[model samples]
Target: MRAVTANALCAGQTRPGSGGRTRVLRLLLTLCALTALFAPATPARAADTTPAQAADTAPPSQAAYFADRLRENPVYVTDQLPREVPRATAPDFARIAKKTGVPTYVLVLPMQSSTGGKELLGAVHDRLGRDGLYVLIEGTDVAQATAYGVRAPADAAATVALYELPYDAGPLRSFERFAEVIAQGGEKAADRAEAARAKSEDDEPAEMYIGPSDRSNQSLLTGTLLTGVPLLIMLSAGYVRRRRRRSGAERRLPRWVVPGTAALTATAIALTAPVVFDQTRSSAARTPSPADLSARVERVAAGLKQDPVYADPESPRVLDARQVDRLHDRIRDFRRSDGGGPVYVSLVPQTPESESAGDPDLFAAAVHAKVGVDGVYVVADPADGTIDVYNHGLRLDSNHLFLDLPDSVAYGDSKADRADDHLLGERLDALMTFLDETPRTDRPGSESAPAPAPRAADEHTLPPLFATDFWPGLFVGAFLALLLSGIAAGLTWIVGALLRRRSATPQSPASAPASASASVSASNLRRTAHAELTSLIGEFTEPSNDEPDDHGEHGRAWDCLDAAMLLVEGDPGRTRERDTDPATLVTVIVLARAGRAALAGEATEQCCGVNPLHGPAVGRRHVRVSREGNRRRMLPVCDPCRDTAVAEPGGIPDRLLKLPGLESGGSRLPYYEATDGPLSAVPDGIARLIDKVRETAGVH
Candidate 1:
């Protein structure tokens, strides 16, 4: 019967695309599905359950199975079993276990229940029936070790590794650290644990402490931005408005324009003032009543009972994220050690509501009374980075807590210079280490230590970063913004009134000197050029009642005029010296002159070589110039400029328009020859002079 069944299975596997083989596979699958539906739950089915439920359901059966596998190979990893630890982790476990010397078995599996520790180790040892060390690792978080009939201090070594290392130290590192402790075996291992803990504490970077200088700098920056930024923006807006009005037909705004803008700016500042500044009750007036203090203590005690670290959410954040984590880690380490009771830490701002007495020790005692537990109670005032410790009932040598404060807390200068959030945590961590190492007496109160001296307040007038006045700086900023805005609006109104009066009173050409107009500042040159351009626009755009003799002449004149208008109109207000402003102004002058000449039935000529702003050329002459390789060419020259060019050595004209050099004052070539301005593309009079040279020479 066995031979017939084996031959039939072999025939199904060997035949390709056979109907019999397909039917046999389908029948086997159907049988599996039916068996799973009707039969009792198996190990495969139990794998889908939660770790806690699976742990509680069948520990003995699972242990027996794993023990048998361990007997074959100490590092047992199964594909049939579900585990958080990767299959690749088996080699690493095998290597670590081999080095331990003692008969060691490490089981890396997914067992997240509380009893997955010692209980599971016990069951596995019972089944394996070996006098050896057994380790159970749960995912990458928990690790438990047990030695049956062996000399390893499994519990003590595990505890030292668990709490001494950082909270985020993974399972492998924990196991490695645990193995090291086991190898040492006794009191030397305990000393090694203390050294590791001390090193970890020393290695952590201290949190940044905001000091008096930081507060002052912050205030100065905030004030300047709030006041200066708005003032500059408003002034720029006014300048832009004035420029636009001067450039266009409309030169004056409505009477309400300036006043209304000022009013709106003031209203905005008023609306934002409350939100910008701190609106909480003044710290000076924060003395809480007896009822409030008791209520606060009761709430703190309740929180401390659940978790050792109790920080009031309503208070200012004194303990940052890292400080809080370190505090919790230190508490856990202390709890796991012998001769130490529960530790309750309260981090609160020094307020009447939070503290009954002004002192931290008194406040801690009050909290301890409500807690109704015999343990160490710690009260910290994070506002000034101060703390006090109290011992209610712990079987240690000392009833009084002796704290060796850090230099920052001990000295006045360092304390004033640096105010750290980690100060409280550091002090608490030191206290915990001291409590753990201190030898216990036979009975409570058998030994008493001297009380440490009270810590002195730093002799600095500048308030800590937390307690700085937020309202004063904002108030000053709003006042300045309002004052400056009003002054600006008043000045605008005054200037407008003066200009309106001047327009009403007409001035003849005799009253306004040509010299006065010629001596205009560089800033006002754009406005002067704008006025001349406007007149030129009117001449070309406005229709003439008298019909012209030549229609083509008028058309040509209008074309030149249009080109000049486009040049002047391009990107107004970008009047940088190196920008297109100089080119645009000169081009407008040259084009306007050509239009006037075209209208008069005269041939248009190139602008003078000395200055394009000198209008049309009288004639052309060959003037040797070193800028053009000392070559002489027929160049346009105005009458006065022509005479000046003749006077200069080599007849080289000193051109009026010169662009800035790469590093020094001005370029070696004239502005038009440089081919670096907006007018280079446009066929203006000066540009036409260098057209062939620029195109053939590749100057552009």
Candidate 2:
């Protein structure tokens, strides 16, 4: 069998009722998407910290190296817990460095310091040239872990995407989960590197699927739909029955159209939503191989870390001079709140004698060495896309800086592009936002007091687009939306099936008019008419509790109304002008029902003409269905009858009382009110009564 082409599908949609189906499908698809967007989510919760401890406040030159992992000896381990470094967890740090080929460092402490982590990480990152990942493990109330780094192999990067660390599950159970990830990720990186090396040597032109062309395959499908469908419609014209009406059948599209359209639209979205909203559009930083870039960054960092390079270079900046003062002011404010950090900005040239060419971390080191580790330093080669940020003496870190980072600068997803997220000016603004957002801790002497974790209003928030949970969340949300849509579609189908089955059964002729008149109840008409009469005569009679059976409890309310209606219809004041005029009687009955705004639909047949009780000359029976808001109601347009109601309270026709539901209800409610009074908001049965009465009595 041959497969149907896309053109066939498009042509199928051009059939009758397609436009309406398309609109409904679009609406359902939109609703499904919106439902997915609001799916329940769990936000990243910040870790709790103990009070700031007495930190190692010594100068960088006098500091001692903790391990051979880094030559700059930037790692800091606090002994406040007697043995803060877990024997098992510490090995994983060394393992990460070995796998990634960049120097790794750790800061194991019992509490956070008044100084921010960003300033410290910046200083280390500058000296190390973003060598490897930085791990900070705090064991206050519970063990908490936070990881930071510049770049790693794709495999290694995937492993370290930790929002918060599991309690010491790695190496002696100190962030053990993070360690396992590193090991798994490291093996992947090694294999990937080997594969890439093998692929590079192969250079052969390969067979292709399709080359670039002026004519697209997609266009052929479109063109076929545009021309083929009309031809088919024209050819099939003779097959259509030429009779005025076929078997007296009405032309309806059928019940399946609405649900079928909704299902198709939802399916299309399910197929396409992932492509549109699944992943962010970005490219990785310019690099040859991941390993090569790491090597270059480390080499540059070594030169910048040397004391001579840092001290001698009073770095010139490429920043606009006018903005320098504002940056300086913001940095000073940063130091005041963040417990002081070395801050400086430098622009390096790419000559062999200076920061090296092809890479930019060297320029960052040169600036950091000169400025020392007591402040913030930014090193950039004006030709490159990123500026390295480093800080010393300050206690903050870069995690809090991403959000504060200015959006004015064109940035990239650094994991892929290796480009800067912010320009120098924007970087300056981010530094300011960081200080504003970081929690300010009091000086170290307040040890006796409970250390309150720094309260940041918008501190450390992950952008939903880049959120760790975003991808998983999308699948979960889509599943829920599809589930709900399916349930609703099923319920609608079941109801439609039941209705179609009932409609298919033949309706009896005797029951047709009775079913049509079901809109107005006999009791409703009788009670309302009797009330109107009693109001007119200024007398009232209440029904008793005696067990009486007319229709049930409500029937008692209309018994008096039944008698009153009989009296009025039987003796409508015998006279030629009033008695001979059936139009006047009908006009009055219509006025009563219309004035009360009671109308749903008229009886199928002319009840007044067929019945022995009705006046002569009433011929046709036109119906008024229940007013489905803004729909034109079926009102009797006889001018002769309308004039009778227009005359006075005496002009109301007594014939209205004989109608099914209107009998007990007199024309009084509509009687006193003017013909032009606002349409009444009576019950549905009452509203239908007027149209039924008018259509029945005023048949022309």
Candidate 3:
């Protein structure tokens, strides 16, 4: 047999130009429909009832308008099997809804799959418009129960899950128990909420009305500004004063530091100033009392019926024409009352232009004004999934009828972001339950009694960021701050290192010939000193394979050589001018090597190659042009000569002219230049010839 699927059957029926195969499928479908008509209900929930469970070609689409659904008992039941929805159940569903104030819906049928059932549920909710706990059934136990536009006190799914009915009992028995739980549970929950709220409010004194006052505000502003401004100024001024008091502190904070500090401080004051002022003054005295509020409700009542729905320009219903239509249909069901005057409903979204607590109150009053009796006003923000309800003319202190907006009506796995029809329906159910618990006692003059003053805004300040339990926001903020601090510290270190390197390495202005030349000369001088020191140190450390000097430090006196080298390197500070400059350090090493040679009874050559002790030689650093003291010089100075030189200061000694690295000044101040003699002073008679040559050449 060529089997035909349910979708194929539906398509064939909807499309035109049927072929022979279509005709055959239609005939087969008709026969199956007839068989279903005579057949008993599908097998129990335990069995996999197929063939019999084939999709119903004739889907009982419950997508008609809500008004149409209301024309009946607000309950509709249809099945794939031609059995009727027990005539007794439909009217009872209506009676219970009217009596208990909880809307009820029931469906009995064979489902093709969960997907199809969910679609059917959605369709039914849209068509009916009234929120109710709906139980879906097939053979025995409840298949599923969903609250559509209604949150029943007893969770439908949970109740069904806990049912204890036996298999032998008909499914109706279990369903009856489920409905009872819904109606009763809803009533009890409402009672509990009302009692709790009343108990909490009983201890409070009548609230006072406090309003914002400008005189107080101006005074506070002036006082804080006076106090805070001076403190900030003092803080900044103190920094300058301290800097000045310090012997060598910088004259000013970096330009950015002062401005940044001011900005940070100003921001803190700006943030806290308002809050501090607000806390000091009391505004409870200015708040409206119940009587005052009741009068206010009457004032707005004139415009109540003018617009049934005071929709904001950005209202969800305005944006989606179809949704408005759906809402209208659902409201129509509630409009049909049992003589206590028909109720009107208002739907308003939270928008900037809309009344803030229209929030929930404005719409409820508006609904009551229009209907002139019981009414419900719902304020919702679809954007954030919040729903608040306000009821007018409820029999009890209508304050309890008001519901705080819940953050989410529908929840799904992580990906979900908005409420679904089921959640909306459940919310509506909660509204119905509250009304059922206590129908209007006072007519409310177009509104519910003074709602337990919507929690004073400031009374419930935002919770601290660091809570005793946990705060994910604080955790995330701290992590980010630490990460940024680490990055900033790393960047600071790198930048400082670069700056030090650049400064220590003297810059040669590539554009300036004089600066560049001077830089080159200094570099060459350091290099030469380094080369000389290295050679001197190596001369002692490394042995000559050929011979030993008079000092008996043979080709190899490894121990003495090591000792001399260690002393020079470790105490280079002995002769270096700065102890750190490379050139001065090299000089220190050379002096150490020379001093050691002198101690070994070996002839030591002076850096300047002049020794007065060797007769007429420039001799020691003390009397030579180097002009160093005895302790600081590599060679000793005789007391008599030092005294004579100090007492009779001559310009320059002829014998002290061949200092290494010295220059002659032709004209510029103290200018000195290298002479033609070997870097050492002229030997015994050699100086006489150099002098004669200088005199011949007319040199000074």
Candidate 4:
């Protein structure tokens, strides 16, 4: 059977090995085939080419071509002739004309000489008749000569220009070219002239191109309707849509999303609010009627002249009637031309003293009146001879008036010449004449309409609803909610865990049967309690008494008492008689003697006890006693001790009595009996005796 089993095992192993080898060989062959199939093909090599040959065949880059073309040209310079004579004469012109085969033309320009002299009298008339070269003399300054590049000698009297015109040029073209040469230098003359002409054409003031009144109105209406209505509607719709979307989103999302969404909504509202506010403001600023404007202007004009307007306390100054009239005219003209808008006027006073205050002669004044009125109105800075014309409650311009007085009147300390008075009189007469010509009108009551109180900033309309307080409150609430929920969940989990552990725990086997197990457990508990009590006694004992006294009585007594108590109390089934046999009694007596010896500070015998065989028998009882001198003070014994019927009375017996045992009776009590005498009458009398000895000996 072993051989058969061995053969079967060998067959199984051999078959698996042979089959595995065959599979491995197949896999290797397949891998080799795959590797061959997937191998990369070799790349074809490229033909070599030289840099120079390649560059020659390749097209030039745009930048390189441009550079080559730029390098092929040489720089050229040309000079142009002037059309007019220079303020000073030119000496290089002749040499230049001869070298270039261009005839020279001389132009003599006039000058304002400090010495009175006649103007130029055809000084180059003979030279102008030349066919190829013409000399033209015209009044010119240094600017004209400089413009033509005509360099003249410092002492020369005239400038000369040489021209070479094309043969087919007409007179007009010739003159135009001549002017061109005078305007710019030779090479760029034609280009400069063309540029200047184009610029002039471009710069020419365009006529106010107003469409037909009806057509303009219609176009404006259409544009306003198309743009304004759609824009307003779109903006309003966008605002509503955004607000609604944000509100919906806020309701759906968590608290954190609300702040950012509210911010965005507020920004949108803020942006659109300005446009609405501006529309209202513009409506408020619309121009009043022309009649109202004219009346306002007249009232403002009247206020300007006799209002005793004060310019400054140090220097007395007021607007003259002429200035007021001029201001009225400017206002009327502006109203007629520009409709109604805000205008600013400046009054320039010429006074040496006023000029010294670091203040300019120009003083600005404003009037909130309308245009096309003759009356004077008192406006800002009415003390100065500055009258501001206003159109539609907006300032237009200021009319300034300068004071003119006789030199004697202005500067009384200085001598006055007749010529000075004539000049002053002429100025004053002009002023008075202007004042006389000024038209007057009644003051308009509506002109002084108080400006509406400025509206408060819109932001202060209501306390910010979306204040920092709002978000923080929400955040705190949410955080508190989350925190409370987490705490509750944690508490629940802990309670559940504790409950599970409590449920899973098994009861301790009903504490076994209280006979053998309980006795043993009780004995162990008593031992532990005795040990703890002994330790407490030790702790209470003085450190100075670590070594036993000369008698060693207290230490010996304590040791005996502890041992005896441990034996009696530690055994739950033992009767008290056995606990206090004769040997035990002798030990307690000896302990009492030891205690007396310790109190007397003398040596005494150390008390000792041991268990013995049967002796006197007595019933179980508790006894207690107190020690006095060498005797114990006993307490009353239990009834069980006196009752002869009770077995083991007092739970101890006298040591001299014999018991029915095989061995001779020892000088100790039987295990189950009590003591017979009144000495053992008290309950726990021996224990009480030991305790009294311990207390007297100060052994705790």
Candidate 5:
């Protein structure tokens, strides 16, 4: 049959649609035959039996008939049976019993493949001897299987099965049901047994239970409550001190220095106090044993082992002792690690328990030993009953480390009266002391030890660059250079301006006589010149009668006189030399005055008698001059004669007007012969001279 099945499977692969149909037909035929072989028989006599007979007589026997068929068939007995079925003997049962701690009631059903008919009977004997509840049964029997909702052929291999019993009972109840079902020979028999068991136990309740006192809970409370008070006090004190310091700084210090110095001092006091106190506390605390640490390690290991995260088959978690050792080693290093340098450390309680203890000593010590440095600190984890170690490195003057231990360690508790308040204060004090005193080289021995020699100075040093001397000097030098440069530039500009002004201004000539004065003579020649010029030019007409003739001869004469007066005004540049040309100016003035006197109907002889060309007359009288070789010879004339000459209608002779060298036509005189010429001739000469003067003055 196997060879035919293999050949047909091969044929199905070789041929497409036809072979697949043939294979399906073959499968159907095989299924039908197996179904027929395992089919249950209907009892013919059971239907015919009367209710009274059914109750009295045993049910018609399908089991016996099936047993007869199985015994009759050699193939069923040999090929269908297991080569080595499990036994219900003492040793075999004991082995299974040790592996699973369940009682025999639960064990017997799963051990049914060894003995076919006598298995249950033998199991009952073994279990009864051991004081167990029941024996094994045909776990796959029709009635037994149907009760548990499982189905298998009578000759099928035995298999273990589980079921959720009624009333939420466990595996023990299911096993008891299996055993009772087979013994009582009915589906409802196991239910009766379960009911009886439940009833027997119902009167008594399970024992009331209590668990052990929590050591971690006590530790937590002690740690927190003890530390909280001191921590609060210390923080409060520090805060008050800072306030005092700030007030002091404001009152005492200069405006510029207040901010920096006050901040620095406050921060220094705050940060340093806690670290120093922590150090002292750490030294004071008791040290725990290595055995205690080992136990803790084991507990942690056990927790990790039970967690599915670590036990999962696909991805397992791993840990090593070295990693733990390194962590402790780092902490130990921190306990000893310190310097009077900028960096400092502080310890604060991190949980209510830690704060309650009023001491960080134990925690600090553990962290110190673990980290090997004084900078290491311990804080508590409130969520998990564990202490956290911290390694803090901050500038020595930082307020960040001046934490209130109670506040810091009490999770989120902000209350002042927490149990761990005192611990916070104490820890702060210890931390401050530690920070103040601990040396730089004193760290964990396990870590790379600091070199013996102090650190070498590099090629560059920051100190000099930021030194007090350097900045002040640099600033002073820069300021002086800038100030002096500005001053010098300004001075140079002023000096240059002065020199330019001096060079541009005109200077008096060095050769000029300083004390020399020139003589000026007053004369009436200008009047005569004015009169002549006005008669020749005629009178000017005005556009309006109210408007005077501003452009007339008199106006012209006034303007000229005013211009001359301006030249004589006190100008710094004007000098006596410019105004002292007496001969020409006096002649012009005298002629102008003479002409004005003539026009005013004054005696012509009196006005014309004053000649600026001649000196003052002898005896306070007038002097007459006659032309002689281009020079004038003076003749003594009486005052009446001068007056008569001025009063006459034609005061001067016309021949006198034609005086030699004074006439408009050319004329000359002999020096010897003209010594004492006529008065008329001299008068005419004077008039002509005056007319010549007026013409030269640009009057007419």
Candidate 6:
């Protein structure tokens, strides 16, 4: 009609004569004004309809439809139901209801309606307006029943039926079990229920019902084992090393000991980890709190800001590419329409954190608060094909939409009606159409909607990604074990090296001075002492055939050489501990030199004051040694050392043996300055050397 009016106005304006155009235009304007005045306003929404009128006009709800059907037959079974409810099982249900001796109404549907099974049962009972037992068996393995003015133990019968039948038992079998309890009176059913409860109690593992205190105790124990085992292994190794060190043995563990112990600790922790993290304890109803909700809302809001359709792939319910394209197109169409701000269609799952918070309106409000934009939000739980629609800027009444929409699209249809993917798309389309029809209430972003109240705080904290999972935990533990093993091995190597050096050198109460040259290998010194002792022994062994009275001196010389050899070569037969210390080796050399003097008839008591390993002293000199501070002492020295000391009056020569400190590890000093044994005492007399060899060789 508007097009014809427009064409008529245009044709009138094109008239050749000015006078004719003026008349035609005035007439066309008058016709257009009449047409505008006569057009009616857009149709009234159902919200505006009176309750009586709405009741007269609105189609029957599923609960009412089922109730109406139950008026004709006691057993109502849909052609399509959950696998747990076998097909064509209406007769079996009817038979069970007849045996109960009272009117029993059973409704078996494939899935739950928008209203839950309990609510449906109540609604159906009210609508039927009869006294009987009402039962509803729906998909998702839910069963609900109630009795109105009936004498049956509903709770006991239900409990008995649930406990007696397997979870996967067909609805007919469950109903039969339920009927059996009803046929037997309340007392009998109660008894059966109690026995079934006892059996279930026996079947349940005690670990399943572990309390918070018990769980905490278990966690504490597990943590202790995880950390304490490794620490204990390290402590044990240290203890073993300490005992050996005190026993005059090497203070180091074997190469594989530390690492092997660490590996065993990690293995024990890994094997027992399941006790702490019981995945079976995780409840499906575990929902996220308000803090967790904020993150998910913000993520969706951010995505929606970029693209209207937020299809989360990680969600249990993911939209296919085709469904995404369709949703995207629908959103574009919504935006192009009047009163449209933005259309956000989210295909996200009912995550554990948000599972119990299934209110799409709450989710929509949260997304809007985050997005800071007025829009139509559609949140779908693809797991069960449940979709929710919320309008922020538009004047759409959600109650009216519910009233107007078909049962199949409004409440997701049964699996037989449509596949989940198509069902979601169809619901979205219905919401869009409803949004287009509703009048505008407010402008987009003009006023902000309040955010939804967050869920209560949950007792359990959300586990970090892969934190409690067996494989991931094991992988992390193994990696940690490897790291600990490397550290242990490295420490073992460093400690072993320090101990070997400490054992190989001499240990004394006093520290070695800086001037000592203790770098000479103790083994080399022992070999040299061994050679000298052997030569001296051979010399004394000749027995001097020309003088038999020379036996006493020769016997003394042989005794000193034999004792010196014992000091150089440790008594491996008695104890494996080597006696070839650097200071001990120096003492052995002194002994050998003293024995040589005994053989030559020019026996001298003193050796070099600077280094006894330089052989026996020939004379004495007044020189300042670093070990004696500024005091000058007449120290006995060898011929070469004496010559050097006399030539350089300012300082002593640098031929002192720098042995390890007599106080602790890593410290060093001159042998004569630090040691109080053969090296220090022998410069005054060969008596200390003789006693040391005699004691070491077990000689009187």
- The 10 consecutive residues of candidate 5 with the worst lDDT sum are 74-83
Tens digit per residue, CA lDDT, model 5, 644-679? 345651322211211121221222222112222112
Sort all candidates by TM-score, best to worst.
6, 1, 3, 2, 4, 5
Q: In model 1, where is the ten-residue run with the lowest total lDDT? A: 509-518
Residue 408 displacement (Å), model 4? 35
Tell me how far the alpha carbon of residue 375 in candidate 1 is from the true structure, in angstroms, after superposition: 60
RMSD of 4: 50.0
Which candidate leads in lDDT?
Answer: 6
Provide the lDDT at 429 for model 5: 36
Residue-by-residue lDDT tens digits, candidate 3, 516-616: 01111234334434443454455554336554453444322332233323434444223233233332332223333343343344433333322221212
Estimate the Cα RMSD of every predicted model relative to the unseen true structure. Answer: 32.8, 35.6, 28.8, 50.0, 43.3, 21.9
TM-score per candidate: 0.25, 0.21, 0.23, 0.15, 0.14, 0.32
What's the ranking of the predictions by lDDT, best on top?
6, 1, 3, 2, 5, 4
> Candidate 6: minimum summed lDDT over ten consecutive residues — where?
507-516
Better of 2 and 5 by lDDT: 2
Which should have the higher TM-score, number 3 or number 5? Answer: 3
lDDT of 2: 0.35
| Clash totals, every prediction | 0, 51, 37, 54, 117, 14
Better of 2 and 4 by TM-score: 2
Global lDDT of each candidate: 0.55, 0.35, 0.40, 0.31, 0.31, 0.60
**For model 2, how does the per-residue alpha-carbon lDDT over 1-700 read when each residue is reduced to its tens digit?**
1234333333343334678877865565566566556544312111111111212321132112222234544344332222223222334445444553444566554333222444444454565554466655454221232234544343333233222222222223333434444555556645544554455457322221221221132233223333333333332232232110221112223445544554565455445444434322111111122233233234434444542112111112234433444566776666566465435544433322121332234444433444345454555444343444543335554433333444332232354143232255555566456556654344321101223221121112212232344344445545544555456556856996797577546332112211111122333334334333443233223348664444432232233223233335533232123222322233333233222211112212222221111211123323222122222222231333234334532222221222222322322222112122111211122224334333443422
lDDT of 4 by residue, 233-348 (tens): 43444444444342221112344444455455545654553343222121111122223223322433343332322222111123333343444454445334432322233222
TM-score for predicted model 5 compared with the true structure: 0.14
What does candidate 1's lDDT look like per residue over 436-508, in tens digits? 6767666553213333222212211234322344445556666676677678778977997897567545232
